[model samples]
Target: MYPTNIKMKKKDKRKVAKAVRGAIKAGIKENIKLFLNTKKFGRIILAKLHI
Candidate 1:
């Protein structure tokens, strides 16, 4: 864990945010493949979710 007096620098914060975004993007991409293979009702739900 980080020390109480220590803080994450701006650059490190941006890097963490970017990594998180990439992971989320990958997860959504995987889900999209699964959604495409699902039934019509599942597709409608997926579309409603804006994915």
Candidate 2:
């Protein structure tokens, strides 16, 4: 029983770590999307100016 409990605790720790990693990845993706959108918008504006 004690061994099983220990194993469960380890699994929980792994799950928490994976969740944290996924959150970080999601944040980075969001930032990249925002950056790309802004860049495209700027390009469009520049084109309108015939630059």
Candidate 3:
């Protein structure tokens, strides 16, 4: 598989980080965030872990 190109500069990187930080600050749980981040392995694993 070939690598897909995604472009970012330092400023863009900071903006993305800031957005993620804001989300974290706004009451989003770390586990839920992790599940969302997995891109497919959704809440099932996290739910099992938490239970």
Name the candidate that leads on lDDT. Answer: 1
**Which scores greater on TM-score, model 2 or model 3?**
2
Per-model RMSD to reference: 6.3, 8.1, 12.0
lDDT digits (tens) for residues 1-51 of candidate 1: 766977899999999999999999999988886977587887777778873
Quickly count the clashes in candidate 1. 0
- Computed on alpha carbons, the lDDT of every model, listed in order, comes to 0.86, 0.75, 0.74
Q: Summarize candidate 2's per-residue lDDT along 4-51 as a digit string, tens digits.
A: 534557789999999999999999977766675579785565557653
**Candidate 1 off by > 4 Å:** 39-51
Candidate whose TM-score is highest? 1
Clashes of each: 0, 0, 0
Name the candidate, 2 or 3, with the larger lDDT value: 2
- Winner on lDDT between 1 and 3 is 1
Measured with C-alpha atoms, the lDDT of residue 31 in candidate 1 is 88
